[model samples]
Target: MQRLFGFMCLVLIATAVPASAQERLKVVASFSILGDFVRNVGGDRVSVTTLVGPEGDAHVYSPTPADAKKIADAKLIFINGLGFEGWLPRLVQSSGSKATVVTATTYITPLKLGSHADPHAWQTVVNAKTYINNIRVALSAAAPADAEVFKSNAEAYRAKLDALEGEIGQFIGQIPSHRRKLITNHEAFGYFAKEYGFEFIAPVGVSTEAEPSARDIAAIITQIKKAKIPAIFLENLSDPRLIKRIAAETGAKVGGTLYSDSLTDEKGDAPTYIDMVRHNIRTLRTALEGVTMRG
Candidate 1:
Protein backbone atom coordinates (compact mmCIF):
# COMPACT_ATOMS: atom_id res chain seq x y z
CA MET A 1 0.00 0.00 0.00
CA GLN A 2 2.89 2.38 0.85
CA ARG A 3 4.58 1.59 -2.47
CA LEU A 4 1.38 2.42 -4.34
CA PHE A 5 1.05 5.70 -2.42
CA GLY A 6 4.67 6.67 -3.24
CA PHE A 7 4.11 5.88 -6.92
CA MET A 8 0.96 8.03 -6.91
CA CYS A 9 2.90 10.92 -5.32
CA LEU A 10 5.64 10.64 -7.99
CA VAL A 11 3.04 10.65 -10.76
CA LEU A 12 1.33 13.69 -9.24
CA ILE A 13 4.66 15.58 -8.99
CA ALA A 14 5.51 14.79 -12.60
CA THR A 15 2.09 15.93 -13.74
CA ALA A 16 2.40 19.17 -11.78
CA VAL A 17 5.55 20.18 -13.69
CA PRO A 18 4.85 22.30 -16.78
CA ALA A 19 5.32 20.67 -20.18
CA SER A 20 6.61 24.07 -21.52
CA ALA A 21 9.70 23.87 -19.32
CA GLN A 22 12.07 23.44 -22.25
CA GLU A 23 10.44 25.82 -24.69
CA ARG A 24 13.28 27.68 -26.44
CA LEU A 25 13.44 31.32 -27.46
CA LYS A 26 12.87 31.74 -31.19
CA VAL A 27 15.34 34.08 -33.00
CA VAL A 28 15.63 35.28 -36.60
CA ALA A 29 18.92 36.52 -38.05
CA SER A 30 19.21 38.60 -41.23
CA PHE A 31 21.97 36.51 -42.80
CA SER A 32 24.39 33.61 -42.37
CA ILE A 33 27.07 35.67 -40.55
CA LEU A 34 24.67 36.99 -37.96
CA GLY A 35 23.08 33.55 -37.69
CA ASP A 36 26.44 32.03 -36.68
CA PHE A 37 26.99 34.77 -34.09
CA VAL A 38 23.51 34.24 -32.63
CA ARG A 39 24.07 30.49 -32.52
CA ASN A 40 27.31 31.00 -30.61
CA VAL A 41 25.70 33.40 -28.13
CA GLY A 42 22.30 31.75 -27.88
CA GLY A 43 23.72 28.25 -27.48
CA ASP A 44 20.96 25.72 -26.75
CA ARG A 45 18.56 28.20 -25.24
CA VAL A 46 17.66 29.96 -28.50
CA SER A 47 16.39 28.60 -31.80
CA VAL A 48 17.62 30.66 -34.79
CA THR A 49 16.28 30.90 -38.35
CA THR A 50 18.57 32.33 -41.02
CA LEU A 51 16.88 34.11 -43.92
CA VAL A 52 20.03 34.07 -46.04
CA GLY A 53 21.40 30.60 -46.77
CA PRO A 54 25.04 29.64 -47.31
CA GLU A 55 26.97 30.82 -50.38
CA GLY A 56 24.16 33.26 -51.07
CA ASP A 57 24.58 37.02 -51.55
CA ALA A 58 22.87 39.22 -49.00
CA HIS A 59 23.36 42.53 -50.87
CA VAL A 60 20.76 41.53 -53.43
CA TYR A 61 18.58 39.45 -51.11
CA SER A 62 14.82 39.75 -51.44
CA PRO A 63 12.72 38.27 -48.67
CA THR A 64 9.83 35.97 -49.54
CA PRO A 65 6.33 35.97 -48.06
CA ALA A 66 7.17 32.84 -46.12
CA ASP A 67 9.94 34.79 -44.39
CA ALA A 68 7.27 37.00 -42.93
CA LYS A 69 5.79 33.96 -41.25
CA LYS A 70 9.19 33.05 -39.84
CA ILE A 71 9.69 36.52 -38.36
CA ALA A 72 6.20 36.88 -36.93
CA ASP A 73 6.78 34.39 -34.13
CA ALA A 74 10.40 35.27 -33.36
CA LYS A 75 11.28 36.57 -29.90
CA LEU A 76 14.36 38.40 -31.21
CA ILE A 77 15.64 39.44 -34.63
CA PHE A 78 19.35 40.18 -35.21
CA ILE A 79 20.75 42.06 -38.21
CA ASN A 80 24.12 43.52 -39.26
CA GLY A 81 22.43 46.83 -40.14
CA LEU A 82 24.45 49.74 -41.71
CA GLY A 83 22.14 49.53 -44.72
CA PHE A 84 23.18 45.94 -45.32
CA GLU A 85 19.59 44.79 -45.26
CA GLY A 86 17.72 47.66 -46.91
CA TRP A 87 14.77 45.33 -47.34
CA LEU A 88 14.49 44.52 -43.63
CA PRO A 89 12.27 47.39 -42.53
CA ARG A 90 9.61 46.47 -45.03
CA LEU A 91 9.87 42.77 -44.21
CA VAL A 92 9.52 43.39 -40.48
CA GLN A 93 6.50 45.61 -40.99
CA SER A 94 4.88 43.28 -43.49
CA SER A 95 5.36 40.31 -41.19
CA GLY A 96 3.81 42.24 -38.29
CA SER A 97 6.64 40.79 -36.22
CA LYS A 98 6.53 42.00 -32.63
CA ALA A 99 10.07 40.76 -32.12
CA THR A 100 12.74 43.20 -30.93
CA VAL A 101 15.07 44.00 -33.83
CA VAL A 102 18.66 44.72 -32.83
CA THR A 103 21.76 45.65 -34.85
CA ALA A 104 24.93 43.64 -34.18
CA THR A 105 27.06 46.54 -35.44
CA THR A 106 25.61 48.97 -32.94
CA TYR A 107 28.82 49.38 -30.99
CA ILE A 108 31.27 48.93 -33.84
CA THR A 109 33.17 52.06 -34.97
CA PRO A 110 31.43 52.51 -38.30
CA LEU A 111 33.70 52.19 -41.32
CA LYS A 112 33.77 54.49 -44.35
CA LEU A 113 32.06 52.78 -47.28
CA GLY A 114 32.95 55.19 -50.08
CA SER A 115 30.17 57.72 -49.59
CA HIS A 116 28.21 55.14 -47.56
CA ALA A 117 28.79 52.94 -44.48
CA ASP A 118 30.54 49.59 -44.47
CA PRO A 119 28.16 46.77 -43.62
CA HIS A 120 30.88 44.13 -43.45
CA ALA A 121 32.42 45.17 -40.13
CA TRP A 122 32.28 41.58 -38.89
CA GLN A 123 35.04 40.70 -41.35
CA THR A 124 37.54 42.00 -38.79
CA VAL A 125 38.01 39.47 -35.98
CA VAL A 126 38.12 42.24 -33.37
CA ASN A 127 34.88 43.76 -34.68
CA ALA A 128 33.26 40.35 -34.54
CA LYS A 129 33.88 40.13 -30.78
CA THR A 130 31.98 43.39 -30.34
CA TYR A 131 29.12 42.06 -32.40
CA ILE A 132 29.04 38.95 -30.22
CA ASN A 133 28.74 41.06 -27.07
CA ASN A 134 25.99 43.15 -28.64
CA ILE A 135 24.17 39.96 -29.57
CA ARG A 136 24.53 38.72 -25.98
CA VAL A 137 23.01 41.90 -24.61
CA ALA A 138 20.25 41.98 -27.21
CA LEU A 139 19.31 38.34 -26.66
CA SER A 140 19.36 38.80 -22.90
CA ALA A 141 16.97 41.73 -23.15
CA ALA A 142 14.68 40.12 -25.71
CA ALA A 143 14.48 36.89 -23.72
CA PRO A 144 15.52 37.61 -20.18
CA ALA A 145 14.71 34.04 -19.17
CA ASP A 146 18.00 32.89 -20.74
CA ALA A 147 20.21 35.78 -19.57
CA GLU A 148 22.67 33.45 -17.87
CA VAL A 149 22.84 31.18 -20.90
CA PHE A 150 23.53 34.12 -23.21
CA LYS A 151 26.22 35.57 -20.94
CA SER A 152 27.98 32.22 -20.50
CA ASN A 153 27.88 31.40 -24.20
CA ALA A 154 29.12 34.92 -25.11
CA GLU A 155 32.18 34.57 -22.82
CA ALA A 156 33.07 31.13 -24.21
CA TYR A 157 32.58 32.18 -27.84
CA ARG A 158 34.48 35.47 -27.37
CA ALA A 159 37.51 33.43 -26.25
CA LYS A 160 37.35 31.42 -29.48
CA LEU A 161 37.12 34.65 -31.51
CA ASP A 162 40.16 36.03 -29.70
CA ALA A 163 42.08 32.89 -30.58
CA LEU A 164 40.99 33.20 -34.21
CA GLU A 165 42.25 36.81 -34.26
CA GLY A 166 45.63 35.73 -32.94
CA GLU A 167 45.89 32.91 -35.45
CA ILE A 168 45.12 35.24 -38.38
CA GLY A 169 47.51 37.97 -37.21
CA GLN A 170 50.26 35.38 -36.77
CA PHE A 171 49.64 33.71 -40.13
CA ILE A 172 49.55 36.97 -42.08
CA GLY A 173 52.88 37.96 -40.48
CA GLN A 174 54.63 35.45 -42.78
CA ILE A 175 54.06 37.55 -45.89
CA PRO A 176 56.44 40.50 -46.39
CA SER A 177 54.87 43.91 -45.65
CA HIS A 178 55.39 45.25 -49.20
CA ARG A 179 53.51 42.23 -50.64
CA ARG A 180 50.51 43.02 -48.40
CA LYS A 181 48.85 45.36 -50.92
CA LEU A 182 45.57 43.81 -52.13
CA ILE A 183 43.22 44.47 -55.05
CA THR A 184 40.07 42.40 -55.04
CA ASN A 185 36.86 42.07 -57.08
CA HIS A 186 34.91 44.04 -54.47
CA GLU A 187 35.33 46.39 -51.48
CA ALA A 188 34.37 43.77 -48.89
CA PHE A 189 37.85 43.46 -47.42
CA GLY A 190 38.32 47.06 -46.21
CA TYR A 191 37.96 46.16 -42.53
CA PHE A 192 40.14 43.11 -42.98
CA ALA A 193 42.84 45.17 -44.70
CA LYS A 194 42.77 47.83 -42.00
CA GLU A 195 42.84 45.40 -39.09
CA TYR A 196 45.44 43.02 -40.55
CA GLY A 197 47.96 45.51 -42.02
CA PHE A 198 47.01 45.47 -45.70
CA GLU A 199 45.58 48.00 -48.14
CA PHE A 200 42.49 46.70 -50.00
CA ILE A 201 41.88 48.43 -53.31
CA ALA A 202 38.65 47.63 -55.08
CA PRO A 203 37.54 48.71 -58.56
CA VAL A 204 33.94 48.86 -57.49
CA GLY A 205 32.55 50.82 -54.53
CA VAL A 206 30.50 49.75 -51.49
CA SER A 207 27.58 48.11 -53.26
CA THR A 208 27.99 45.02 -55.45
CA GLU A 209 25.01 46.26 -57.43
CA ALA A 210 27.26 48.75 -59.21
CA GLU A 211 29.92 48.03 -61.83
CA PRO A 212 33.55 49.13 -61.99
CA SER A 213 34.38 51.60 -64.75
CA ALA A 214 36.96 50.84 -67.44
CA ARG A 215 39.06 53.74 -66.15
CA ASP A 216 38.88 52.30 -62.64
CA ILE A 217 39.98 48.87 -63.85
CA ALA A 218 42.82 50.37 -65.89
CA ALA A 219 43.99 52.40 -62.91
CA ILE A 220 44.03 49.37 -60.58
CA ILE A 221 45.84 47.33 -63.22
CA THR A 222 48.43 50.09 -63.62
CA GLN A 223 48.82 50.30 -59.83
CA ILE A 224 49.26 46.52 -59.63
CA LYS A 225 52.11 46.71 -62.14
CA LYS A 226 53.70 49.78 -60.52
CA ALA A 227 53.40 48.36 -56.99
CA LYS A 228 54.42 44.86 -58.17
CA ILE A 229 51.35 43.34 -56.50
CA PRO A 230 52.00 39.60 -56.44
CA ALA A 231 48.33 38.60 -56.57
CA ILE A 232 44.78 39.80 -57.12
CA PHE A 233 41.68 38.02 -55.76
CA LEU A 234 38.07 37.44 -56.83
CA GLU A 235 35.36 37.50 -54.19
CA ASN A 236 33.01 34.58 -53.62
CA LEU A 237 30.01 36.71 -54.63
CA SER A 238 31.60 38.91 -57.30
CA ASP A 239 31.90 38.47 -61.08
CA PRO A 240 35.31 36.97 -61.87
CA ARG A 241 35.85 38.81 -65.12
CA LEU A 242 37.36 41.92 -63.50
CA ILE A 243 39.96 40.11 -61.40
CA LYS A 244 40.69 37.77 -64.28
CA ARG A 245 41.30 40.74 -66.55
CA ILE A 246 43.56 42.36 -63.95
CA ALA A 247 45.55 39.14 -63.52
CA ALA A 248 45.80 38.54 -67.29
CA GLU A 249 46.71 42.12 -68.13
CA THR A 250 49.15 42.69 -65.26
CA GLY A 251 50.60 39.14 -65.32
CA ALA A 252 49.94 38.97 -61.56
CA LYS A 253 49.00 35.58 -60.15
CA VAL A 254 45.33 35.24 -59.30
CA GLY A 255 45.14 34.43 -55.60
CA GLY A 256 42.86 31.67 -54.30
CA THR A 257 39.17 32.40 -53.80
CA LEU A 258 38.33 34.81 -50.97
CA TYR A 259 35.12 34.42 -48.91
CA SER A 260 33.62 37.88 -48.99
CA ASP A 261 29.83 37.95 -49.16
CA SER A 262 29.10 34.35 -48.12
CA LEU A 263 30.35 31.04 -46.75
CA THR A 264 30.94 27.63 -48.35
CA ASP A 265 28.64 24.62 -48.33
CA GLU A 266 28.73 22.10 -45.48
CA LYS A 267 30.97 19.65 -47.37
CA GLY A 268 33.29 22.44 -48.60
CA ASP A 269 36.22 24.29 -47.01
CA ALA A 270 34.32 27.15 -45.34
CA PRO A 271 31.20 25.77 -43.67
CA THR A 272 31.05 28.43 -40.95
CA TYR A 273 32.07 32.09 -40.39
CA ILE A 274 35.26 31.16 -38.49
CA ASP A 275 36.13 28.61 -41.14
CA MET A 276 35.68 31.28 -43.77
CA VAL A 277 38.32 33.54 -42.13
CA ARG A 278 40.79 30.68 -41.69
CA HIS A 279 40.31 29.54 -45.26
CA ASN A 280 40.76 33.06 -46.63
CA ILE A 281 43.99 33.69 -44.70
CA ARG A 282 45.39 30.27 -45.62
CA THR A 283 44.61 30.86 -49.29
CA LEU A 284 46.25 34.26 -49.19
CA ARG A 285 49.36 32.85 -47.44
CA THR A 286 49.75 30.00 -49.93
CA ALA A 287 49.41 32.30 -52.92
CA LEU A 288 51.78 34.94 -51.54
CA GLU A 289 54.33 32.36 -50.32
CA GLY A 290 54.22 30.52 -53.69
CA VAL A 291 53.37 27.26 -51.90
CA THR A 292 50.33 24.99 -51.77
CA MET A 293 48.14 25.15 -48.66
CA ARG A 294 47.78 21.92 -46.71
CA GLY A 295 44.49 20.81 -45.21
Candidate 2:
Protein backbone atom coordinates (compact mmCIF):
# COMPACT_ATOMS: atom_id res chain seq x y z
CA MET A 1 0.00 0.00 0.00
CA GLN A 2 2.89 2.40 0.94
CA ARG A 3 4.71 1.73 -2.36
CA LEU A 4 1.49 2.35 -4.38
CA PHE A 5 0.83 5.63 -2.48
CA GLY A 6 4.43 6.84 -3.19
CA PHE A 7 4.03 6.03 -6.94
CA MET A 8 0.69 7.92 -7.04
CA CYS A 9 2.31 10.99 -5.34
CA LEU A 10 5.14 11.02 -7.93
CA VAL A 11 2.56 10.97 -10.77
CA LEU A 12 0.60 13.83 -9.19
CA ILE A 13 3.80 15.93 -8.80
CA ALA A 14 4.75 15.34 -12.48
CA THR A 15 1.32 16.51 -13.67
CA ALA A 16 1.44 19.56 -11.37
CA VAL A 17 3.96 21.34 -13.63
CA PRO A 18 2.30 24.49 -15.08
CA ALA A 19 0.90 24.40 -18.63
CA SER A 20 2.84 27.60 -19.47
CA ALA A 21 6.06 25.76 -18.62
CA GLN A 22 5.09 22.87 -20.90
CA GLU A 23 4.02 24.98 -23.91
CA ARG A 24 6.07 27.52 -25.86
CA LEU A 25 5.33 31.24 -25.81
CA LYS A 26 2.80 32.22 -28.50
CA VAL A 27 3.77 35.23 -30.68
CA VAL A 28 2.31 36.86 -33.79
CA ALA A 29 4.56 38.81 -36.13
CA SER A 30 3.06 41.27 -38.61
CA PHE A 31 5.26 40.21 -41.58
CA SER A 32 8.01 37.88 -42.70
CA ILE A 33 10.96 40.08 -41.73
CA LEU A 34 9.64 40.69 -38.23
CA GLY A 35 8.82 37.00 -37.99
CA ASP A 36 12.44 36.18 -38.77
CA PHE A 37 13.67 38.48 -35.99
CA VAL A 38 11.30 36.95 -33.45
CA ARG A 39 12.36 33.44 -34.43
CA ASN A 40 16.04 34.28 -33.99
CA VAL A 41 15.59 35.91 -30.60
CA GLY A 42 12.78 33.76 -29.24
CA GLY A 43 14.45 30.56 -30.47
CA ASP A 44 12.93 27.40 -28.96
CA ARG A 45 10.96 29.41 -26.40
CA VAL A 46 8.50 30.83 -28.94
CA SER A 47 6.08 29.66 -31.59
CA VAL A 48 5.51 32.51 -34.10
CA THR A 49 2.57 32.92 -36.52
CA THR A 50 3.31 35.42 -39.25
CA LEU A 51 0.29 37.28 -40.67
CA VAL A 52 1.98 38.19 -43.97
CA GLY A 53 4.09 35.23 -45.01
CA PRO A 54 7.03 35.07 -47.42
CA GLU A 55 6.76 37.42 -50.46
CA GLY A 56 3.50 38.91 -49.13
CA ASP A 57 3.20 42.71 -49.01
CA ALA A 58 2.07 44.03 -45.63
CA HIS A 59 1.28 47.52 -46.99
CA VAL A 60 -1.83 46.27 -48.77
CA TYR A 61 -2.47 43.07 -46.81
CA SER A 62 -6.11 42.48 -45.88
CA PRO A 63 -6.21 40.69 -42.52
CA THR A 64 -8.55 37.69 -42.44
CA PRO A 65 -10.67 36.09 -39.70
CA ALA A 66 -8.01 33.43 -39.28
CA ASP A 67 -5.42 36.13 -38.71
CA ALA A 68 -7.71 37.51 -36.01
CA LYS A 69 -7.80 34.10 -34.36
CA LYS A 70 -4.01 33.94 -34.39
CA ILE A 71 -3.82 37.34 -32.73
CA ALA A 72 -6.49 36.33 -30.24
CA ASP A 73 -4.35 33.42 -29.08
CA ALA A 74 -1.00 35.26 -29.09
CA LYS A 75 0.68 36.42 -25.89
CA LEU A 76 2.50 39.14 -27.84
CA ILE A 77 2.16 40.70 -31.31
CA PHE A 78 5.27 42.19 -32.95
CA ILE A 79 4.82 44.90 -35.59
CA ASN A 80 7.24 47.00 -37.65
CA GLY A 81 5.27 50.10 -36.61
CA LEU A 82 5.91 53.60 -38.10
CA GLY A 83 2.70 53.42 -40.20
CA PHE A 84 3.96 50.25 -41.83
CA GLU A 85 0.73 48.31 -41.26
CA GLY A 86 -2.23 50.61 -41.87
CA TRP A 87 -4.65 47.67 -41.74
CA LEU A 88 -3.33 46.35 -38.38
CA PRO A 89 -5.32 48.58 -36.04
CA ARG A 90 -8.68 47.45 -37.37
CA LEU A 91 -7.59 43.83 -37.26
CA VAL A 92 -6.42 44.16 -33.66
CA GLN A 93 -9.73 45.76 -32.70
CA SER A 94 -11.73 43.07 -34.45
CA SER A 95 -9.66 40.29 -32.91
CA GLY A 96 -9.97 41.73 -29.42
CA SER A 97 -6.53 40.37 -28.52
CA LYS A 98 -5.21 41.30 -25.10
CA ALA A 99 -1.64 40.55 -26.23
CA THR A 100 1.04 43.13 -25.63
CA VAL A 101 1.93 44.94 -28.85
CA VAL A 102 5.68 45.52 -29.34
CA THR A 103 7.18 47.69 -32.10
CA ALA A 104 10.50 46.25 -33.28
CA THR A 105 11.74 49.55 -34.70
CA THR A 106 11.37 51.43 -31.42
CA TYR A 107 14.77 53.14 -30.88
CA ILE A 108 15.97 53.76 -34.44
CA THR A 109 15.60 57.25 -35.89
CA PRO A 110 13.24 57.03 -38.86
CA LEU A 111 13.93 58.46 -42.30
CA LYS A 112 11.09 60.59 -43.63
CA LEU A 113 9.70 60.37 -47.16
CA GLY A 114 8.01 63.78 -47.47
CA SER A 115 5.30 63.72 -44.75
CA HIS A 116 5.50 59.98 -44.00
CA ALA A 117 8.14 57.98 -42.10
CA ASP A 118 9.94 55.29 -44.11
CA PRO A 119 9.29 51.93 -42.42
CA HIS A 120 12.07 49.93 -44.11
CA ALA A 121 14.87 50.59 -41.61
CA TRP A 122 15.76 46.91 -41.75
CA GLN A 123 17.35 47.61 -45.15
CA THR A 124 20.55 48.50 -43.24
CA VAL A 125 22.31 45.83 -41.20
CA VAL A 126 23.19 48.41 -38.53
CA ASN A 127 19.51 49.12 -37.99
CA ALA A 128 18.90 45.38 -38.00
CA LYS A 129 21.01 45.11 -34.83
CA THR A 130 18.68 47.62 -33.20
CA TYR A 131 15.70 45.50 -34.22
CA ILE A 132 17.25 42.37 -32.71
CA ASN A 133 17.90 44.22 -29.46
CA ASN A 134 14.29 45.38 -29.36
CA ILE A 135 13.02 41.84 -29.82
CA ARG A 136 15.39 40.63 -27.09
CA VAL A 137 14.09 43.24 -24.63
CA ALA A 138 10.45 42.48 -25.42
CA LEU A 139 10.89 38.73 -25.08
CA SER A 140 12.72 39.17 -21.76
CA ALA A 141 9.83 41.30 -20.47
CA ALA A 142 7.24 38.73 -21.50
CA ALA A 143 9.22 35.77 -20.18
CA PRO A 144 11.50 36.91 -17.39
CA ALA A 145 12.67 33.38 -16.64
CA ASP A 146 14.22 33.09 -20.13
CA ALA A 147 15.89 36.52 -20.12
CA GLU A 148 19.45 35.15 -20.12
CA VAL A 149 18.74 32.86 -23.05
CA PHE A 150 17.25 35.73 -25.04
CA LYS A 151 20.24 37.98 -24.27
CA SER A 152 22.77 35.33 -25.35
CA ASN A 153 20.87 34.64 -28.59
CA ALA A 154 20.58 38.34 -29.42
CA GLU A 155 24.30 38.92 -28.82
CA ALA A 156 25.23 36.04 -31.10
CA TYR A 157 22.91 37.30 -33.85
CA ARG A 158 24.25 40.88 -33.54
CA ALA A 159 27.79 39.56 -34.09
CA LYS A 160 26.66 38.00 -37.36
CA LEU A 161 25.03 41.28 -38.41
CA ASP A 162 28.27 43.15 -37.62
CA ALA A 163 30.18 40.80 -39.91
CA LEU A 164 27.63 41.30 -42.70
CA GLU A 165 27.94 45.08 -42.40
CA GLY A 166 31.72 44.84 -42.81
CA GLU A 167 31.34 42.61 -45.85
CA ILE A 168 28.84 44.96 -47.54
CA GLY A 169 31.06 47.98 -46.89
CA GLN A 170 34.07 46.28 -48.53
CA PHE A 171 31.99 45.27 -51.59
CA ILE A 172 30.38 48.69 -52.02
CA GLY A 173 33.79 50.39 -51.72
CA GLN A 174 35.02 48.59 -54.84
CA ILE A 175 32.19 50.03 -57.02
CA PRO A 176 32.98 53.52 -58.38
CA SER A 177 30.88 56.45 -57.12
CA HIS A 178 29.67 57.21 -60.66
CA ARG A 179 28.44 53.58 -61.06
CA ARG A 180 26.56 53.65 -57.73
CA LYS A 181 23.20 54.90 -59.07
CA LEU A 182 20.36 52.49 -59.96
CA ILE A 183 16.55 52.33 -60.10
CA THR A 184 13.95 50.09 -58.47
CA ASN A 185 10.13 49.76 -58.59
CA HIS A 186 9.61 51.55 -55.28
CA GLU A 187 11.40 53.75 -52.69
CA ALA A 188 12.11 50.90 -50.28
CA PHE A 189 15.91 51.32 -50.22
CA GLY A 190 16.19 54.80 -48.73
CA TYR A 191 17.81 53.53 -45.53
CA PHE A 192 20.11 51.29 -47.55
CA ALA A 193 21.14 54.17 -49.80
CA LYS A 194 21.68 56.44 -46.82
CA GLU A 195 23.72 53.78 -44.97
CA TYR A 196 25.75 52.91 -48.05
CA GLY A 197 26.51 55.55 -50.69
CA PHE A 198 24.10 54.67 -53.53
CA GLU A 199 21.44 56.54 -55.48
CA PHE A 200 18.04 54.83 -55.99
CA ILE A 201 15.22 56.28 -58.06
CA ALA A 202 11.77 54.69 -57.98
CA PRO A 203 8.50 55.35 -59.85
CA VAL A 204 6.21 54.53 -56.94
CA GLY A 205 6.55 55.96 -53.42
CA VAL A 206 7.30 54.06 -50.20
CA SER A 207 4.09 52.01 -50.27
CA THR A 208 3.72 49.34 -52.98
CA GLU A 209 -0.04 49.80 -53.44
CA ALA A 210 0.28 53.38 -54.79
CA GLU A 211 -0.25 53.62 -58.55
CA PRO A 212 2.14 55.88 -60.46
CA SER A 213 0.64 58.31 -62.98
CA ALA A 214 1.71 58.50 -66.66
CA ARG A 215 3.48 61.78 -65.91
CA ASP A 216 5.47 60.09 -63.13
CA ILE A 217 6.74 57.41 -65.54
CA ALA A 218 7.62 60.04 -68.11
CA ALA A 219 9.51 62.05 -65.51
CA ILE A 220 11.43 58.95 -64.39
CA ILE A 221 12.33 58.10 -67.99
CA THR A 222 13.50 61.65 -68.59
CA GLN A 223 15.66 61.46 -65.45
CA ILE A 224 17.06 58.07 -66.48
CA LYS A 225 17.97 59.39 -69.92
CA LYS A 226 19.52 62.57 -68.50
CA ALA A 227 21.63 60.63 -65.95
CA LYS A 228 22.43 57.67 -68.24
CA ILE A 229 21.40 55.27 -65.46
CA PRO A 230 22.76 51.79 -66.31
CA ALA A 231 20.21 49.41 -64.81
CA ILE A 232 16.73 48.98 -63.32
CA PHE A 233 15.80 46.11 -61.00
CA LEU A 234 12.45 44.43 -60.27
CA GLU A 235 11.22 43.87 -56.69
CA ASN A 236 9.76 40.51 -55.68
CA LEU A 237 6.62 42.19 -54.30
CA SER A 238 6.12 44.57 -57.30
CA ASP A 239 4.74 44.11 -60.80
CA PRO A 240 7.53 43.32 -63.29
CA ARG A 241 5.68 44.90 -66.24
CA LEU A 242 6.27 48.44 -64.88
CA ILE A 243 10.01 47.89 -64.52
CA LYS A 244 10.26 46.11 -67.89
CA ARG A 245 8.40 48.98 -69.59
CA ILE A 246 10.74 51.52 -67.97
CA ALA A 247 13.82 49.51 -68.97
CA ALA A 248 12.58 49.14 -72.56
CA GLU A 249 11.76 52.83 -72.87
CA THR A 250 15.00 54.09 -71.31
CA GLY A 251 17.32 51.49 -72.87
CA ALA A 252 18.50 50.62 -69.38
CA LYS A 253 19.20 46.91 -68.83
CA VAL A 254 16.78 45.02 -66.62
CA GLY A 255 19.37 44.07 -64.00
CA GLY A 256 17.70 41.39 -61.89
CA THR A 257 15.20 40.73 -59.09
CA LEU A 258 15.64 42.43 -55.72
CA TYR A 259 13.93 41.27 -52.51
CA SER A 260 12.73 44.49 -50.92
CA ASP A 261 9.50 44.27 -48.88
CA SER A 262 9.51 40.50 -48.20
CA LEU A 263 11.65 37.36 -48.28
CA THR A 264 11.31 34.21 -50.39
CA ASP A 265 10.64 30.66 -49.23
CA GLU A 266 13.38 28.26 -47.97
CA LYS A 267 13.72 26.80 -51.47
CA GLY A 268 14.13 30.30 -53.01
CA ASP A 269 17.18 32.57 -53.32
CA ALA A 270 16.60 34.68 -50.19
CA PRO A 271 15.04 32.59 -47.42
CA THR A 272 16.70 34.38 -44.47
CA TYR A 273 17.54 38.02 -43.69
CA ILE A 274 21.29 37.53 -44.23
CA ASP A 275 20.67 35.70 -47.50
CA MET A 276 18.39 38.48 -48.74
CA VAL A 277 20.97 41.20 -48.06
CA ARG A 278 23.82 39.24 -49.64
CA HIS A 279 21.70 38.42 -52.72
CA ASN A 280 20.70 42.09 -53.17
CA ILE A 281 24.28 43.47 -52.91
CA ARG A 282 25.62 40.65 -55.11
CA THR A 283 22.99 41.41 -57.77
CA LEU A 284 23.70 45.16 -57.56
CA ARG A 285 27.49 44.67 -57.79
CA THR A 286 27.18 42.32 -60.74
CA ALA A 287 24.97 44.78 -62.63
CA LEU A 288 26.84 47.98 -61.72
CA GLU A 289 30.52 46.94 -61.76
CA GLY A 290 30.61 45.61 -65.35
CA VAL A 291 28.57 48.42 -66.93
CA THR A 292 30.39 51.34 -68.49
CA MET A 293 29.39 54.62 -66.83
CA ARG A 294 27.71 56.93 -69.34
CA GLY A 295 27.31 60.72 -69.22
**lDDT of every predicted structure (CA atoms):** 0.84, 0.86
> What C-alpha lDDT, on a 0 to 100 scale, does residue 281 get in candidate 2?
86
Instruction: List where candidate 1 sits over 4 angstroms from the true fold.
Output: 1-21, 204-223, 235-249
lDDT of 2 by residue, 1-295 (tens): 9999999999998899764467888999999988998999988888899999998999889989999999999999999999999999899999999999999999999999779999999999988999999999999999999899899999998888989988798778888888788878667899999889889987433334565666767777887888888877645325678777888898887787788889899999888899899888888877887643221
- Cα lDDT for residue 153, candidate 1: 93
Residue 231 of model 2, lDDT score: 79
Instruction: Tell me model 1's lDDT, rounded to 2 decimals.
Output: 0.84
TM-score of each: 0.85, 0.85
Q: List the residue pairs that clash in candidate 1.
A: none
